[model samples]
Target chain A: MLGPHAPVATPEQLAAAREAREAYRGGLVAPTSGVAHGLVQANLIAVPRDWAFETLLFAQRNPKSCPVLEVVEPSADGRVEPRLAPGADLRTDIPAYRVWRDGELVEEVADATAAWAEQPLVAFLIGCSFTFEAGLADAGIPIRHQELGTNVPMYRTARQCEPAGRLSGELVVSMRPIPADRVADAVAISGRFPAVHGAPVHIGDPGSLGIADLGAPDFGDAPEVREGEVPVFWACGVTPQAAIMASRPPFAITHAPGHMMVLDVPDAAYAA
Target chain B: MLGPHAPVATPEQLAAAREAREAYRGGLVAPTSGVAHGLVQANLIAVPRDWAFETLLFAQRNPKSCPVLEVVEPSADGRVEPRLAPGADLRTDIPAYRVWRDGELVEEVADATAAWAEQPLVAFLIGCSFTFEAGLADAGIPIRHQELGTNVPMYRTARQCEPAGRLSGELVVSMRPIPADRVADAVAISGRFPAVHGAPVHIGDPGSLGIADLGAPDFGDAPEVREGEVPVFWACGVTPQAAIMASRPPFAITHAPGHMMVLDVPDAAYAA
Candidate 1:
């Protein structure tokens, strides 16, 4: 893989994403920003088999924010199947994993074999925007946060996701300001990738979603909206984190923000 | 409301669905097939609050077969508020309810108050094809089973639903034979109503979905396929019943196949 933070790779490099997964599994502990440009990048969430039912429901109920690509059940021999990666190890494919206990993040580790080995755990690979952003870029629309070299601005919206079981929380959204002329193109492009967070949930007026300040966000840096550009918000994968904080399960794991798991599938596989 | 086996109501009659709800509350116990022509019809599934998490997950995991319109948690005063109906008492809104204990159907009753009163129960209102069938009829597509005045033929498929907790079973699909020329129109019509078992899961061959015979089905009666027609299958709401049987949950409640809860919202409201 190219040096960390290199611009998004070419189609050929993305098709050969096993190298990126190799970099992660072989102890490269950096955020997976641009490792495999045209492949799926997943946000990770792991919970014990006992808690797996509700957590999976949490993602399923809020599909916009948590479109699950595949769930590796602890009972299924816990093998990392090819829906994402053919030979990937669910316990260590990501660059980093965060361990949360009782709603508090307690540890960030390069691998989670220790936690996973003790008890059967279900690993959920939720769709993230890396593939859709690649689609957006290919469609000639620029991604603001990537160009700025910062995390996508995310905010907790007033919109409530349909509650399922013990998991319920406000929908969290990531913002990208596209030129007014390109907003339709942006929607058309992103809408095709529903497995990733699809079309803009809200297109205008921050207050409508209860986001107080465009300059201040609940997570990530402020977005840079250009003149004649509109802020387009898509459901963010970080929603599971907010849900975790609210539901307060005893044990959980997630990928550190921006440190995603690079999957082996081509991004085109996710396009609707 | 009309008697059992009444003709499908006119649009104006559907607009007055509250009268149907009243008939149900006033001890008129009959299947609700023709009660409200243009309103939404839902399948009911109730489990204790402790089992709700897993049951909800099962629906979320198998959305095509079990589209949940609303979930009334026992913790929330447990009164049903249909997104489609206001001031509806879920306990009596449906004409008939089936009680299952240890995976066996033990009783069919008009009122579940006696069972529901003793313990907190979470009721799940699942999407059914009443609205989509209306769309199909409007599009000039034939609904073979409905035309024959029989239940839609349902079969156990080889494709297993993504298991959630203790709920795992082969997907159950309802079959309809649309004229070969109109299959596209059938899909286009049903695709608009995502809330009501959107679109066909499989088309053309019953064997593709693991149905051994078109003349024989595991649950519903066999379907009659006309010349120049193709068998189209949509995920059936009976899926949860199969899951409950497979998982063997201690107690559960479901609507009898032909009995449904009529909601107040217009069918058009569910169109995408």
Candidate 2:
């Protein structure tokens, strides 16, 4: 967690984040794990103007899994821009895009400008766990997925999220194996940053959350749980996507899994 | 703050809360400060359906002052019920209601059923600062208003809340005087319950927040500041009303200041 006097974002970090977005806008597609160091990265989800209320209510109801960083309402002229990253087009700044029609993945594209233009889109920028990874590392707690150089393992639990209007789905959680004794430290550190997925939702026993196997996940890469380590689960940003899949909005757009939009704000800006 | 194992609400507390609601429903009009001890109390704001989206977005944007506990959407056939207290009629269960027309307070009534029938209303149950006073008292921090048996002082500040579509206003804050040495302790205690206007927005020197005089507040009672005490201000639940006053919608309803809905849930349910 950042101290009270920490600067939100340094001038150098701001320039680097903008450069990364420019590169993505030019057709670079990849996971954005370490793209813009010290800056915040967000999960993207955009829906039609009519469905925007339910979507916003869903995030407000399930804040643990879907902490909204910013909401960019569709403009009168059909223009959209996230305040988190001013001047960066929401349609093309992300590394990759996933277009959904009737809750199914219709296409994966390098740019979503055409899909976004189909109708007025209300875009939501949601907080990603990547914003709090540095805090855990600073506390001497290891992040298993970062060490293995893979996407964090995620699973869809039996737990049903609070239904909001026409949107409802199971909770999706990302897992990280922590040394047995350091689990408390990990919870304490991450709990300080509620804006970014906060504390672990489940500390052990995946079966309690209805996950059958540790090596097999519903989304992302598999985990490597070693001896003396316990699997800890934090609410994942994929929850909103899970809701989109279940609720089946007629038209929707989101970032391809693990591909995020880098924001100009610093990670400390999200620290509680 | 409650421990992990604390029960949400005792059976006795639930019964007391229900009885209090029944009394209010039977035309007993009064403030709900100590009516049902250990139960949560909330500020009420109901708006027409057309303005619900903008109102919800405003709350989402200004979470500190408008931490929404529950949103009771109008049901088919125009029925309204708040899930916070089952079997409770939102329009008639509250002790008092304020009828607003074009940003003006037209009347204060004991029951709002007649006014509610005029339009489909979406009611918002917002967190109240009374929810955290116990925590402060438990930490040995004095709450000035409680000692003097007066309403907590509230003020409209120079700080502008992040605006949403068609809804905007200056932030309103509730003030409580704390001993100079215990200011930090008060902050740490209240900060635990983010759902209920967490932490102080300003510590001392009310002029910094554009208040010309501390005693003459925009709302609520005049505070009694004693020797060795500093005034601490927190985001007040009345902020949404401030927005209703600033951005006058066609129609609106709210609980009269200091008269709140006593919910069946325990105060611990809101603890972070």
Which candidate comes out best when scored by DockQ?
2
Question: What is the C-alpha lDDT profile of model 1 across A7-125, one tens digit per residue?
Answer: 44356775557776777778778656556777778888888767775676677567789887777655367555534566778677787888889888889888877777766677788
Clashing pairs in 2: none
Chain B TM-score in candidate 2, rounded to 2 decimals?
Answer: 0.93
**Candidate 1 CAPRI assessment class:** incorrect
RMSD of each: 6.4, 2.9
In order, the Cα lDDT scores of the candidates are 0.77, 0.86
Q: Which pairs of residues clash in candidate 1, taking residues 3 or more apart in a chain or in different chains?
A: none
Q: Which model scores highest in lDDT?
A: 2
Q: iRMS of every model, one decimal? A: 9.0, 5.2
| DockQ of candidate 2, scored on C-alphas against the true complex (2 decimals) | 0.33
The superposed Cα distance between candidate 2 and the true structure at residue B39, in angstroms, equals 2.7
Query: For model 2, what is the error of residue A78's alpha carbon versus the real structure, in angstroms, after optimal superposition?
Result: 5.2
Report DockQ per prediction, comma-separated: 0.17, 0.33
Predicted candidate 1 versus true structure: per-residue lDDT over B60-80, tens digit per residue: 567778887777654367565
